[model samples]
Target: MSRISSFVEIYFPGVAQRFQKGIALIDERYGVKAMYGLFFNFCLNVSRPGQVDRLHCLPHADYKNLALAVCVVFVYGEFNHKEKCWLVMWEAGIILQIPPGVFVAYPSALFYHFNFDISNLEVCVTDGADFPTPQNSRRLDGGASGRGSCVWFNQASMWQTAEIGVDTIKQAISQGLDATCDNQAFLDSLVFAKIMGDKGQPQPTL
Candidate 1:
């Protein structure tokens, strides 16, 4: 997790700073790291060796997560990433071809996203093919081939508490802030800091 955090800090410095700010706020509020205070969590998609039906999900938005914050996902494992595990984003109308050990960050609360099915295509040529099968997919140490994702995100409640002095929209409204007027203004005031790239250019957005 430290290494992944460092990588994001190096490449996506703005995102790293945003996460750290949130973490600091939460830690200060609770006087300790909460049980779910971690910036990243692992989800191992394990299955039978070479199983083409590995775990997946339907298109959905993570409504409970912070809307202004981005979710960072790190995909890794021994599966054939080239043919399988592409990320399908409905709002973007694009399927991202993320190779193994790569990291992708997006606003999960805004985009409806899912994954492609595990590849079932058979390889005809061996020149540069990545065809993992039951017989050859197992590691020498007998570990099964599978995929895993590490997701980093901030919960909506944490940000709400930090920014609005409350942990829920209802609480904020009850405290005299109008949801459609003052709430949107408060959200607008909480802008992400602009990040400049090494070449003096603004960082690109997804």
Candidate 2:
């Protein structure tokens, strides 16, 4: 996992630093202890790897939670963008060309995307990840074989997690905030918020 992270950081510098900061922010904001999990969360695939559409081109499809993409070789694939409908970029049903080394960064989870079929010779490798997304990540550093074993701390039971998200707290109340949210839960929540609020002023040296 570290090797893969290093390789990806080669093409996209500051990956480790930026993502490390992002992970910390998520953990802080959501009152959850999270880590990279240090896994290959992307794919290095061939051109037109998926099935072609009726038009014989890789039709408009949205990539969920994608952040960036890079074409390594002669991957000259055309791309089209649509918000909620099928619309070409330049001409009537035409798309924009993607030259090699012309890296693209976008929030794929928020937009619809279209791509044309690439020639067999044009191989591409895309690397991307969503930011600030919350997940129950395991403590990889403390485990043998670096597999999922230990959690940083039981967020639900250990941390002041009732203050994690307002929506979650409300939902918990609506459904059942029981077994947690004891008599002192409200004070604990407020104190937790105050402490975290006072923080984030100075960027801590990692």
Per-residue accuracy of model 1 over 61-162 as CA lDDT, tens digit each: 999886755677877777666566678889889888777788887879989999874343443223335686665563222122477666777667666666
How does candidate 1 fare on TM-score? Answer: 0.66
Q: What's the lDDT for candidate 2?
A: 0.32
**lDDT (tens digit, per residue) of candidate 2 on 1-206:** 45434533454343334344444655667655443232213333333324431222243433333223211111223332111112223223344444333333322323344543333223332233433222522221211111111111112321223233334545656766542434354323221111123555633110
Off by over 4 Å in 1: 10-12, 34-44, 48-53, 118-145, 178-203
Error of 2 at 124 (Å): 27
TM-score of each candidate structure, all chains considered together: 0.66, 0.28
**Clashing residue pairs, backbone N/CA/C < 3 A, model 2:** none
Q: List the lowest-lDDT window of 10 residues for candidate 1.
A: 136-145
Error of 1 at 36 (Å): 8.9
